[model samples]
Target: AEECINSKIHEIKTLEQVIGKLITRYNVLEENKLKSLVNIYEKMKPKDAARTLNELEMPTLLAVVKHMKDSRTAPIMAEMDSIKAKALTVELVTRNRLPFATAGSGEGDG
Candidate 1:
């Protein structure tokens, strides 16, 4: 029983390390994909980019905006549909705001 337990524990540890490496690899791949997309957007003219961007769903659009440089993003936003641009900006700001707001609230709990 003791040896079996030890073996199981070792197996669990090995599985955890494998899971950690997989997560790291996944994150790197996602970052690279985001960078590649940002490059594609940056290379397009603002109006063309806006038209392409308009077809993307909101979450995908927000993810692109998050990774994109502000200088490049600004021109695209200017060319985008005003209503869509405003909504995207609001969603981006909300994503950033949640963490800070939650952290600030937690500090006073002590």
Candidate 2:
């Protein structure tokens, strides 16, 4: 019985190790997929990209935008629907993660 228990423990340990590796592989693939999406967005015009991006879940959209250059992302933001653009801008501001200044209400008027 003791030997059987030891064997079971070993099997459990092996399974745990395999699970850990699988989780790591899954995460890597997900990261790569996000990177590929970012690359595709970077290649598209801001207006076109914004239209397509509107269909993405907010977290996924944020992840892609987070990887983009601020200059590039700004144009995309400008092209996006105002409500969505405002929501994303607010989220970024609240997280203290935005890299560039958002245009304020009439702040630029001379």
Candidate 3:
């Protein structure tokens, strides 16, 4: 009985390691996709992008904003609805504390 239990434990540990590896791979893929989306948004006109972005769910918008550079994020943000912009800024600065918060704070944007 003890030997059987030990074998089961070993199998569980191996499965756990495999699960961890899969999760890491999934995260890398998700990051890559987010980067691609940000690149597309960067190339778009801010007002047009803002109009499109306004329709996205908040979590998706959050991910896009988090991945974006200050210059790319700023104009779109400027064109967003005022309440939405304020809400997103609060979420970004307070919740995530993403580097984007400080990067554009005293902007001489390029």
Candidate 4:
């Protein structure tokens, strides 16, 4: 019985270590992908990027734009459809004001 308990504890510890590594890797990958998206948007022409960005999911579009500099994003926003631009602006504004909002921190969100 003692042997079994020791084995189980060891397994749990190993699993925890693996999970920690996986989380670190995932965070790195996400940061890299965001940087890539920012670069792509920055280099693309404003109107072209606006059209492409409008087709992205709102969450995705926001993620890309949120990392970008104001100088890079302004021209793109100018080229965007007014309604879409306004809606995104509102979300950005809200996010800035409530950076720690917990409105949807429950399970099943992912």
Candidate 5:
């Protein structure tokens, strides 16, 4: 009975570990999907791109803004309607000013 209980506990622990790993993997996969989508949108014309970016969730918008190069971002921001551009500019500036937040960190923080 003792051996059986121990074996069952070991199985449960293994299952828990597997579940944790799977959840982490899924989150990574979801992030990648969002990144790819943003990349596709970025490649579009500025007007179309701005519209697409506006449609995205705030978190996703932040991610896309973080990934964008300054040159590309400037042009995209310039092309967007004033209200949208202003909002995005604020986000970009805020993201730049803060060192700890944003997507990938270190070195080129923004």
Candidate 6:
């Protein structure tokens, strides 16, 4: 009877260890899935997308702007009020380092 009880106790301990490992693996997978979903959602959100574009380094922003269709680009730029649009345009033109153009140059001059 004593030997039987020892075997049952050992089985219970082994079962508990298995359950703990499964729980650990489940938690890791859940965390990874949540992180991936959050990243995807951030990329897909229009506001976040605009902010990301606004924050990109000048060279990268220029490259992205060059490839974007004007139809798509105009609305995003227009979403900001006039002042912000002008500021961002100036920033893009100056590589984020200088003020907007002075009055001398006509719109078609360049």
Query: Which is the better candidate, 1 or 3, if ranked by TM-score?
Result: 1
For all candidates in order, the CA lDDT equals: 0.91, 0.86, 0.90, 0.90, 0.77, 0.63
Off by over 4 Å in 2: 95-110
Judged by TM-score, which candidate is best? 1
Q: Please rank every candidate by lDDT, starting with the best.
A: 1, 4, 3, 2, 5, 6
User: Model 5, stretches more than 4 Å misplaced?
Assistant: 1-9, 93-110
TM-score of 5: 0.64
Runs of candidate 1 exceeding 4 Å displacement: 98-110
Off by over 4 Å in 6: 46-110
Candidate 5, poorest ten consecutive residues by summed lDDT: 98-107
User: Candidate 3 — which residues are off by over 4 angstroms?
Assistant: 97-110
lDDT of 6 by residue, 1-110 (tens): 99999999999999999999999999999767655643453444445556666665655555555445555566666654556567668766666343444434756644
lDDT of 3 by residue, 6-93 (tens): 9999999999999999999999999998899889999999999999888888889998998889988999999999989988888877
Candidate 4 collision pairs: none
Q: TM-score ranking from best to worst?
A: 1, 3, 4, 2, 5, 6
TM-score of each: 0.87, 0.78, 0.82, 0.82, 0.64, 0.41
Candidate 1: pairs in clash: none
Error of model 3, residue 66, in angstroms = 0.9
lDDT of 6 at 110: 40
RMSD (Cα, Å) for all candidates, in order, is 4.1, 7.4, 6.5, 7.2, 6.2, 16.2
Error of 6 at 5 (Å): 0.7
Report the Cα lDDT for residue 51, model 1: 94
For model 6, which pairs clash? none
Model 4, range 1-110, lDDT digits (tens) per residue?
Answer: 99999999999999999999999999999999899989998999999999998888889989999999899899999999998999899988887764445566864654
Candidate 6: Cα lDDT at 35:
58
